[model samples]
Target: MRLLELTLPDAVENVALDEALLRQVEETDGQPVLRLWELESYAVIVGRANRIERNVNVEACRRDGVPIVRRFSGGGTVLLGPGALVFSLFLRVEKDRHLANIDAATAIVLDRVLTPLKGLVASLERKGTSDLASEGVKVSGNSQRWLRSTFLHHGTLLYDFDVSLIERYLSDPEREPDYRQGREHADFVRNLPISRDELRKSLTEAWDARLDPPELPFDLVRDLVRDRYRNDEWTFRM
Candidate 1:
C-alpha cells in the first residue's frame, strides 16, 4: 500500500483524482492505498445518479455562493470545505467475498481506516453501508466504487467543520429523516481534541502495517483534475 499526502487547492479536482486512482489500481493490480488530503474551500458534492435539484437545495447553495459538484461514487449528498479531512482508500480485491456487495466493501474500509481511531472517544462503527459513527453520532461519511476488481473508497472527516453551514447550505434544511435520532451538524459536529497533524499521524501509522507504500507522483492527480473535474458539465449536471 502506498501512502500519499496531498495538499491541494479545493476545486472539483477530487472527483477526477478518484477516477484516475481507480484506473491506476485496476491497471497495475496494485496494493491498498491510504490517500490523505484536505479541502481548501467549500463545495457541495452529490452522489452519482442523484437528482441535483431534488437532493440539494439549489437556491440555498446559490444564495450562499456554494459550488456544487458530483462524485463518481454512490452515497448521500455531503458538504466538503475547510476543516474537513478527506481520505481515499484504493484497494485490490483479495478474496471473492470482498467483491460481493457494497456492505462488505464498506466493512473492509471501516476496519482498515477507522477502527483504530479509538483515542477519539470510541472506535468507529458502520451506521449504514457508508457512514461511520462515534458515540452514536456520525463523524464521517463514505462512498465507494469498484472497477474491475479494484475498490476506490473516499470520504470526509469532520474534524472542525462549520456545522451551522450545513443547515444553511445542505438540501435538507431540517435534517429531518436522518438527524431525528442523533447529533447533527448544527447540534454537535465539532473540532477534535487533537491537532490535524496528530490525527493524520495516527491514521498513517495504522495504515503502515496494512500495505506497502508507494510514492505516487502528485502530478498524476494534478493532471487528471485539470483535464476532467473543473468542467461545467461535470459539476452541475442536473
Candidate 2:
C-alpha cells in the first residue's frame, strides 16, 4: 500500500480528503492507500448520519470556538486535536471475507494494527466493535465507509490527547458498543502511552506502507469541503 503523508489545515479538509481519495481509487482502480495525518487544532467530528444534538454539547463547542464537522463514515462522534494520530486505509474489496462484513473487517484490521503495538504496550485488546483498548480503556476508535468495489477504513489513535476535551465537548454517545458499560468518556478513553513517532512507525511498517503523494484530484476535495463538510446544512443533517 502507498502512504500519503499529508495533513490539511483543519478538520473539514482532512475529512474531505479521505472521501476524495476513496473516490479517486474507485474511479481509477488505483492502488490501495494508507494516509496518516494529525490535527494541529481541536475539532469535533460526528458520524455521517449521527444526530449532532444528541452526541455533542453544542453550547460548549460554540463557546470554545471549536468547529464541529461531520465525516462521510458511520461511527460515533470523536474529538480530534493535537496528539491524535489518524490512519486511513483505502482498500479494494475482492473475495476477502474479512473486508465484506463490518464485524469481520473491524476484527481483522484491529488485529493487524495491534501486531505492531503488542511489544510496545502490555495487554492491548479490541473492545466493543471497533475500539482498541488497553486495560479496559480505549486507545483507538475506528469507523468505515464502503463502495461497491472499495472500502475506506479509518481510525484515530490517541497517543497523548487531552482527555478532558472529550468530556468538555462530547456528550455520552446515544449508541455505544456493549463493552462500553456506561463508562463516561474521560474514564473510558486513554492515551496510548507511546510517542507519536513510535506509533506512526509501527503502523506504517505493519502494513508495509510506502510513502508517496496521493496524486488525488484536489478539486473534488475542495468542492466537498465547500459543499458538504463546511456547510452546516449537511453537517447537521441527521
Candidate 3:
C-alpha cells in the first residue's frame, strides 16, 4: 500500500480529498493507499447522510465559529481538531470476503490496525461496528464508503483531543453503537495515551505501507469542495 502523509488547509479540503482518492483509484486502477493527516483547527464532521440539525449543536458550533461539514461515509458525527490523528485506507475490493461485508470489513480493519496497540493499552477491543475502545472508553471511531470495486475506510484516533469540545459542538446522536450505553460524550470517549508517531509507525508497518506520495487529483477535490462539501444545500440535505 502507498502512504501519503498530507494535511490540507481546512475541513472541506480534508474531507473532499478522501473521496477524490477513492475516485482516483476506481477510475485509474491506482494502487491502494494509506493516508495519515491532522487538522489545523477545530471542525465538526457529520456522516454523509446524517441530518446535521439533528446530530449537531448548531447554535454551539456557530457561536464557537467552528465550521460544520459532512464526510463521504456513513458514521456518527465527530469533532476534529489539532490533536486528533486521522487515517484513511483506500483498498480495492477483491475476492476477500472480509472486504465485502460492512461488519466483516470493519472487524478485519480494526483488528489489524489495533494489533500493535494491544499490549500498550490495558484492553483494546473492537466495540460495535467500527469503534475501538480501551477499558470501555472509545479511543477510535471509523466509517467507510464503498464503490463498485474499491472502498475507503477512514476514522479518527483521539490522541490528545479536547474531549469536552465534543459535547460542546455535537448533541446526543439520534443513533449510537450498542456499547455506548447511552453515556454522554464526556463519559463515552477518551484519548489514547500514545503519541501520533508511534501509532502511525505501527499502522504503516502492519500494512507494509510505502513512503510514496500520491499524485492527488487536486482539481477534483476543489470541485467537490465547491459543489458539495462547502455547499449548505448539499451538506444539510438530510
Candidate 4:
C-alpha cells in the first residue's frame, strides 16, 4: 500500500480533484493510498444524482455566498469548508463476494480512522452507514464508490470548524434529521483537541503501521490535484 499525503492549502476544486486522482490511481500500480485535505472555504457537496433544490437550499447558499457543488459519489449532502479535515483512501482490491460491498468498505475506512483515534477519545462507534460517533454526538462521516478494481472512500472529520456558519449556510434544517431541529451547532459539532500538524503526523504513522512504506503515492496524487481537480467544469457541473 502506498500512502499519499496531499493537502489543499486553499480549497481549490476538491470534489473534482478527488475524482481525477481516483481515476489516475486506478490506472497505475493501484496501491492503496491515504489522502488528507482541507477546504478553502465552506461549500455544500451533494451526490451526483441528488436534486440540488430538494436536498439543499440553493438560494440561501447563494445569498450567503456559499458554493453548492456535486460530487462523484453518493451520500447525503454535507457542508464543508475550514475546520473540516477530509480524508480519502483509494485502493485496488479484487471484488470478493463478502467485503466488497459498500457497508464493508465503510467499516474498513472507519477502522483505519479509529485505530489512531483510540485512547485519545472514547472508542468510536458507527452512527449509521458511515458516521462515527463519540457518545451520542457525530464526529466523522464517510462515503465510498467502487469502480473497476478500485474503491474511493472519502469523508470528513470535524476538528474545530465553524458550527454556526454551517448552520447558517446549510439552508435545509431538515438535512440533519437524526439530530433534530433542536440541535445546536456548538453542541452537535466539535473540534479535535489536536492541531492540524499533529493529526496529519499521527494519521501518517498509523497508515505506516499497517501498510508498506508509501512511495510514489505523494507525487502522483499531488500532480493530479494541481492539474485536473482545479478545473471549473469539474466543480460546478450538474
Expressed as tens digits, the lDDT of each residue in 31-112 for candidate 4 is 5777777886788877665666566767788897777766778776778887788878776767334457788777776777
lDDT over C-alpha atoms for residue 231 of model 2: 95
lDDT at residue 80 of model 4 (Cα atoms): 87
The CA lDDT of each predicted structure is 0.70, 0.91, 0.90, 0.68
Residues 141-223, candidate 1: write the lDDT tens digits.
88888887888888877777777787666654222235336544555444455567766776777667344456454576677
Best by lDDT: 2
Q: What is the C-alpha lDDT profile of model 3 across 1-238, one tens digit per residue?
A: 8999999999999999999999999898889999999998999999987898899999988898999998889998999998899999998888465687778788888988988878577598999878999888999999999999889999888898999889989989999888899999999999998898888888898789999977989999999999999898888888
What is the overall TM-score of model 3 with all chains considered together? 0.97
Candidate 3 residue pairs in backbone clash: none
Locate the minimum summed-lDDT window of 10 residues in model 1: 171-180
Those runs of model 3 whose alpha carbons end farther than 4 Å from true positions after fitting are 95-97
Location of the lowest summed lDDT over 10 successive residues in candidate 2: 93-102
Residue 100 lDDT in candidate 1: 66
Model 3, position 14, has a per-residue lDDT of 93
lDDT of 1 at 181: 60
Question: What C-alpha lDDT does candidate 4 achieve relative to the native structure?
Answer: 0.68
Which digits, one per residue and each the tens of the lDDT, describe model 2 over residues 1-238?
8988889998899999999999999888888899999999999999988899999999999999999999999999999999999999988887465587778888888899999999899789988889999998899999999998888999999998999889999999999888878999988999998999999899999889988766977999999998988898998887
lDDT of 2 at 204: 93
TM of each candidate vs. truth: 0.82, 0.97, 0.97, 0.78
As a whole number from 0 to 100, the lDDT of residue 19 in candidate 2 is 97
